[model samples]
Target: MVEEAARRDLAAIAITDHDVVGGIAEAQQAGQRFGVEVVPGIELTAEWDGRLAHILGYFIDPAHPELVVGLERAREQMAAHVRDVLDAARALGVEIDEAALARYRGRYVSGATLVLGMLEQGILRGSPHARQLLLRASREPRPFSAAEAIALIHAAGGVASLAHPVKLRRSEPLLPARTFAPLVAAGLDGIEAWQIVQGPTVRDHYRRVAEALGLVATGGSDCHGPRSVGMRLGTQRVPAAVLSAMKQCWRDRRRALPDRTGSPR
Candidate 1:
């Protein structure tokens, strides 16, 4: 990711892997080598108002004990959920490779990764089949609530932001003020006002919402990987000022609290 950022001439990029911070250290080192800044970040899954919401934590302490413990718990739950998904697939006569699945045991196993693995191993048919399995698996409960996610981010000395609010509900319309109110009250520091998936109008709408609520407006490409189609590095071109604002918010939070032995709580 750092190499790609440098190749794209990006000043900086955040490594917000879902439920994991293991790669941040290496990415940061690569950032130094490549002359690009790497923000230590994590994308956490949380439940809010009976739906799943993704929260992005920026400038986090990757080694924070509390954050590590919480993420470990979440990973365990996700592993169990993957097993349940495999069981469901077997019940439907889909053959799965137990050995291949075992390789993901101690690592972060996202639903998409699992599904794609199955598809690659010929355990699942195609995209439509994978989509069905994902839909079924998504019904499983998340381990953390939105408030807990925000608190965890804060404890890790990071600013919590809502990621791509427009995609939070596919069947429903964009999140209203009432929806964002609870999250903001729970210590959400920003909203993803720009993303590759959202057009200019949608981005403007989220920017307006962020401003109205006094939340920082952030943006990202939401890139999954270098090879991911249609999602490329530096696609959104978020201004440096956005990152500056987030840094200010982080500094303000640290000042409001008492200092600790290590990084501010």
Candidate 2:
């Protein structure tokens, strides 16, 4: 992806891998090699109204307690969830080998490697197929409330925004602006204003939404592993000024709220 981005004349990309910060280091190394600025990030899953919501955390202090602890807890839950997923696949007449899973483990947190493995080996054909299999298997999803997830990101001195909300199945308005009314009220900081995957119309939709809702706007590469599918590193160019604006929003919120950590709302 980095090479592609370089060809496209892009400058920077944030590596927002799911629920894990493990890939940030590797992305940084490659970004350095490719002359792209690698922004560090993580995509976290939080429960809201009994459904899972994905949160993208950007520019975080990796060693801070809020983010580090929550991520560790999530990693543990997902590890167990992966085992359950394998078990459910067996029940559904698909045998997912443990060896296949091991190949995708540890390096990235979200079990995305596992999902990709299924695709690569024909265990699953695509993302939609994988999602259906998980649902049909009654995939035992894990827990981390939105409030908790956002707080962790904030506590780590980073900013949190809703991820591609539309893609998560149960969540409405996956693209975010229409989806974030309550979240914005709950101190949600930003929206992904632009994305490579979204065509011009979707980009316009999200931009208008971001403005209408008074939310900070951000973007990233959303890289999963070495082989990022559609997006290359630095493909989505978020001005450094935009990141500064998000952090300024965070500072404003922190000043208004008490130092004590708990429910952000």
Candidate 3:
């Protein structure tokens, strides 16, 4: 990934691994070796109106104890959700070998992985079937509310942003625009105004709303990994100014605290 980023002329990148910070140190090391800036980040799942919402935390402290604790809790929840899905699959007459699934332990397991596991075992035919089966399961571990998630991100010395507001609406009934105001009131620092998959018009619409609301407009490629999801590194570069502003936001947040020391509590 570092090599690819360098090849593509990306000056910096954020490793916003889902629900975990364990990879940040290695990513930072690679960034150093490859001459690229690595923004420490995490994509946290929060609940709003009983639906799942993704919150992106930029410039976060990887070693923050509170954030660590929160991640552990989230991991447990994810594990439970995975277990439930496996169980549901079994009830549907799809056999699963426990040993095969054991390999994913000690790491954050994605729903996609679980679905793929079933497909590999010939339990499901394709992505569509896997998705439908998982949706039928309807067993998700409760997540932090949006307010709590924003508070946690702030506590971790990170700027909180609503991730892919447009995509988020498709999964749930609540419109992103409708929820933006309440989220801002709850301390949201920004919105993902630009996304690689979104066209210029969609990005512009989000940018306009963010500007109107006085919220920071952030963007990313939303790439999972090198060559994954057809995402080309550096194709959708985040502006240097946006990165500067986010860093400044982190600094200002730190300065606002009564304690001069920024150590994890």
Candidate 4:
């Protein structure tokens, strides 16, 4: 993965393990070894209406108690979920086994890793299946969701941003201004205003929403490990002011809470 980033000439890279922060150290080490700035991050799967929502945490401080507690819990639950999926698949005669599970576990280190692998390999189509089959349930071991991801993001001394909301085709439900109004009112900090997949119309809509919501506009490659989804790593740009506002908010929340629990109501 680090080699791929180098090939792209990226100045910085973020390691966002889904619903967990287990890879921060390795990512930092790789960044140092490769001379790319490493941003410690987690891509959390959050419980939403018995479904799932993804919230990305970037530049997060690792040792914060609340964030650490939830991430640890998430990792355990996800491991269990994977086990359950293997079990189910075995019962249904899918030809999957414990050895297969072990082989895949290391590769499927995060939520994005698991889902992206499935997508690339043509196992699942999108979020709904990723939720109902893997995240919400599975054949052997399934994935699991953490507590409110936005809260975890705030607690970790990081920025909280929606990742690929529009991809769901239910953006109006998942990220509608009305739905986000209260979150913004409660300190929702940013949105991925410019994304790799957004067409011009979607870009314009999200941009207007960002301005109206007083949220920082950011963009990302949503790069999963070394793989490319027609989006080159680090090619997307997030304005410095937007980045500053998110960092400032994180710092302020860290100060106010002091106990490592940034409780967003």
Give me candidate 2's TM-score against the actual structure: 0.74
Question: Could you tell me which residue pairs clash in candidate 1?
Answer: none
How many clashes (backbone atoms < 3 Å, residues ≥3 apart in a chain or on different chains) does model 4 have? 17
Which ranking of candidates, highest TM-score first? 1, 3, 2, 4
Task: Report the number of backbone clashes for model 1.
Answer: 0
Q: To one decimal, what is the Cα RMSD in angstroms of model 4 from the true structure?
A: 5.8
Q: Candidate 1 or 4, higher lDDT?
A: 1
Against the true structure, candidate 4 has what lDDT? 0.61
- Candidate 1 residue lDDT tens string, 1-265: 7887898999989989888898899999999999998889999989988888999999899899999999999988887887888888787777677667545433456565565567567755654466677676556547799999999999998999999888889865466666699999999999998898888988898998899898999989998774346547898899999989888888888887768323321
Q: List residue ranges in candidate 3 displaced over 4 A.
A: 97-106, 126-132, 136-142, 171-178, 260-265
> Each model's C-alpha lDDT?
0.83, 0.66, 0.76, 0.61
Candidate 3, residues 149-176, lDDT tens digits: the string is 8998988888899888877667642244
Q: Considering summed lDDT, which 10 consecutive residues are worst modelled in model 1?
A: 101-110
Best by TM-score: 1
C-alpha TM-score for every candidate:
0.89, 0.74, 0.86, 0.73
- Runs of candidate 1 exceeding 4 Å displacement: 98-107, 126-134, 171-173, 260-265
lDDT value, residue 168 of candidate 4:
42
Please provide, for model 2 over 90-146, each residue's C-alpha lDDT reduced to its tens digit, 9 standing for 90 to 100: 766777766755565446323455565666678765444567665543443545778
For model 4, what is the alpha-carbon lDDT of residue 44?
Answer: 72
Query: What lDDT score goes with residue 9 in model 4?
Result: 81
